[model samples]
Target: MLKAERHAYLLQQLSKQGRLSAIDEAERLGISEDTLRRDLRELDMAGALQRVHGGAIPRPPVPASYADRRGDDRTRKVSLARVAASLVRDGQVFFLDGGTTALCIAESLPVNLRATVITNAPPIAAALIDHPGIDVYLAGGAVAKRSAVTVGTEATDFLRRFRADLGFIGVCALAADAGLTIPFAEEASTKRVMIEQARRVVALAGSDKLDIAYPYVVAPTTAITDLVTDHTATEERLAPYRLRGITIHRQR
Candidate 1:
């Protein structure tokens, strides 16, 4: 097949499967693995897909800013948020990562349920203002304007002071192989600290974020104890995470 046709075929496969194995696709296309690797490389250079160790996954969508992403897939975020909120115990201490979904999770918590929430996002802290039973601690640092989250050494160091019962990580992209990834470097650092300080890590991702990858990786799939996503996620797509011993919670 021509190079253009081959690229189209690969892209089509990615749309259907959300992931592509190099050897399998090469065999299917009646080409050598080396040739397929070259095709994947070209596609990666063109920003079509992200190539992983032995396969490729879709590139994560990058909205203009956090403000823009607030309205994108709002319902799905709420659904995942509800599932995440259900995991909270009344007296547990939780680390809330920054993102629109994290805000939803904060809002979804029961009014009278008492808990301590440490977060890097001011918006999430503000959302919990009326929750009289909940204690909110906003991390201090340089806030990234794009994500509206505090990042840097100061934020990460602040998180080290207390151990949390659960960490609700709002990931930009999640894949079995690539794990959890986000676009910015300093935010990734802050998230890493959150994961480290928590006993259990729960990732809140939308269906669109599944099987996709981004530039900066926060943690491997094994790092997360639970994954909460919308009902739109297929069982086939979630099988990998389940096999990794992550409890899956799908929105009803």
Candidate 2:
């Protein structure tokens, strides 16, 4: 068969079965394994599908802006933040990721809470100012206009200074195999540093982010200690991560 025919077949099979194995597909297409891998890699780079450990999974198509996201899911964000806040204990240091969800998490902290917060977002730093007992540290860097979060070599360099007790991560996408991903490479770089420096990491995501894959890979699902989500998530949607030992904390 021609390459176009093979591509069509691959997409059709993935649409029917949800995932595809290169070994099986190569045999079915009567193609060599190396050529099959090249095709799959091309497809992956073209954003057609996600190449996993041993197969490919359908990649589905973010919150576009900071203000829009902050205002988008007000109630659900609050609920997710409450779950994130519950994980915080007195005197523990935190690394807060930038986004509406992290803003919600920052806002949800107890007013009398005593803790140290280190973040890369200016707005997140500003939001935490009213918490009487919490000390906020803003990582210095040139801020990105789109997300209003600090990004660049400077930001990641600053984040490396402290080893946080807990890290609050927010993402545009989350998948069982692709892990946590976002669209911006700069943001992804900063998030990787946050995940590396934290002793424990808690991911705050909406149910809409689940089972989805974004372009830039931040960290693997294994990096998260706990996942705080809203009521929209189902057990089936969460089972893959749970099976891999990542704890899921849905809305109570």
Candidate 3:
């Protein structure tokens, strides 16, 4: 496989199993141990993995700044964003949680569709400026410098004033056991409000986010009505979600 493809495979393995066996990954890829080592070294240098003797372990995922996360899963986020946008209809008021993928939804919105977007992310509100049909509302609060999002009590309280038809939330990690989660406590708190206030909630995540867990819990697994992810995810990896009756939409 190509380097990019191998990198995705390696990370996906880390997401699922949390560590790698050099022998197993090498055999799985049908590549020599030397080539696998080189690949692991490259990924380590890129801050994608932590290399160790004989194998690799999941690099302690320190959530990067929004700018960094925005570029990391561009393809998968864009694909998932497209699917999320498809769920919106004109004249609907929706809640958009802050993140790179949520920004993608704003940018992917249809040209002729008219809707109202209420968000804690200034970046996402700014992205909709050119979309003539959409109305944007910005919730006021302390802005998170790294994520360019509103947080704190002001933002959460402001969000409580409006009820939305749909809520498109971005998560740092997702697992059958952990449900939806993020590293930021304030962000997780805001998301819980969004979930309770929205009529239908959709959580958008890249395939790599599956089976991962973060520091704070946003909500339980049953809180979300649907999940949208990239087709890169295997059915085997998605079985748990399906069994839970959470409708899964895989972007092609």
Candidate 4:
């Protein structure tokens, strides 16, 4: 392919997969690492991609803050939240992870549902505070300023005492190979503990998160019992998870 065509394809790959290592891109494109670096440099110069330590990610028009993320797909999240909330029985225990998607599920919880909620997110706790039937347990630890969630060794230790019926997780990326992952190492560690302590793992993710990989690995994809995502996700894209014995729920 021509350089321009190759560059365009690279951007498409990055958008679909979130990030790509230079060596992998080079191998995929049948080019040398130097050539891939040059391509990444050009894309970076044009503000088409962000060059991270050893990979490139697609550039957003404007930088997204943690608060900004909650508003990006309000309609989709609400629909997914409703489906997620419906999955909760009246008296089950749930662990809500620290992510905007989980926050939506926490807000959409039924007023009379009597589930016990264990969460590290301040927003999730605050959202459920007024619900008379639901009991909220806020895990204590170091607070993550960006997401307003408590996470650390202390929090993980606290969670070990109790097991939840369901663990709702969020992620920066997911791959069949890499599983669920977030950007920060500490957060990933806490999340791993959450997965281990819960009987079933349910991931609330958007289509954008599929097939993506981050620097840190939280759990393997096989760990998830169910995945809830926007309706735009293709059946082909979700087929692998089904093959892995994961139930996939798509929210319109």
Candidate 5:
């Protein structure tokens, strides 16, 4: 293929899959890896894609921000959120982790429900601000600019002081072997503290996030008591968690 044709092909594939690893793209296109890297660089410079460690992801249609991220996979997130919200009980203290999924759960919370929600997510805190029966405690710490979540030793320390009845953790990725993994180191530490301080940990995951693993391991597979996912998650994919005695809830 001509150079222009190859680049166009790469852009098409990225549009379909949302991302492509350099090695994988090279093999698929029958091009040298160096050539593929050059193509990726050209595309990156053109503002067509964002290059990551070993892959390129599609550039957002507009300038990307945290708000943009929260809008993706809205349907699946809403389903997962509804299932997660159903697990909450009145008069309980709950820990809400910071992520798009957790934000969805906060939005889906019943207005009349009574509970104390502790979180580091400004978005979640804002969503609960007007609830008369629900009290929200925003954890104080250094804010993570990318995720808008408070993190570091201070946040983790505050979490350890209270034992929450339940925790809703949002994960970037999950594998049967790798458990829950996220991209950031400080976020992993904060999530670990939430898991430890809660009596029960409920993970809110979308189907697309399953079977994927990231660099930082937040918690082991055994740490989670339940996982709520969208209806698209198959029984075969959920078998491993079931075998490990974790309840799997699918929302249609």
Candidate 6:
């Protein structure tokens, strides 16, 4: 088949099945595996699909700006925030990532809860400022105005200076095999450090963000100790994360 014909077939299959196995599809198409892989690569670059270890999946939806995301999934984000807040403990050092969901988590924390929160998002830090018992440390770096968060090499280097008891990451895209991913490389750098330096890493993602892939990978799904998602997530959707030994925390 011509390359365009092959690309169309691959895309059609991905849309119907939600995933593709490189080996199996190559055999079906009567083509060498290397040729198939090349096609997948080009498709990925074009933003038509996301290439995983052995196959491909759909590309994730484009994320909204920081301001817009804050209002996108208000109820679901609040529900997820409450559950995530319950996991925090007194005196624990926390790495709170930047994003609308993380801001909600900061707001949901108990007023009297005593803990140290290290964050790169100005909004999250601002939300915690008046919490008498919580100590907030904002990371220093060049701010990415669209996301309203601090990012860059400086932020990642600063995060390496301290280890935290728990790290809460705002996930852009998550898949069982492709792991945690985002579109921006700088933010991915900071999040990778948060995953590495924390004793436990919890990914805060809504159900809509699952089963998709983004351009920049943060860490493998195994790096996450827990996942906090909304109630709409089905057991079928979460089973792969469970198999990876990631404890699931759903909104009640």
Best by TM-score: 1
How many times do residue backbones clash in model 5?
A: 0
Query: How accurate locally, in lDDT, is each candidate?
Result: 0.91, 0.85, 0.84, 0.82, 0.83, 0.90
Number of colliding residue pairs in each model: 0, 0, 0, 0, 0, 0
Tens-digit per-residue lDDT, 128-169, candidate 2: 888899999998888887898999999998899999999998
Better of 2 and 5 by lDDT: 2
Give the per-residue Cα lDDT of candidate 5 at 53.
Answer: 58
- Please say which candidate is ahead in TM-score: 1 or 6: 1
For residues 1-252, could you state the per-residue lDDT of candidate 1 as single tens digits? 999999999999999888999999999999999999999999999999989999899987765698998897888788888889999999999999989999999999998899999999999999999899999999999999999899999998898888999999988889999889877777888899999999999998878889988788899999999999888788988999999999999999
* lDDT tens per residue, model 4, 29-130: 899999899989998899777676566765433325578887888888889889888889999998999888888899898888899999888889999999
CA-only RMSD, every prediction = 1.5, 4.2, 7.6, 4.3, 6.2, 3.4
TM-score of each: 0.95, 0.79, 0.77, 0.80, 0.75, 0.83
Which candidate leads in lDDT?
A: 1
Model 3 residue 251 CA deviation (Å) reads: 1.2
Question: Which ten contiguous residues of candidate 2 have the minimum total lDDT?
Answer: 60-69
Model 6 vs. true fold: TM: 0.83
* Cα displacement (Å) at residue 146, model 1: 1.3
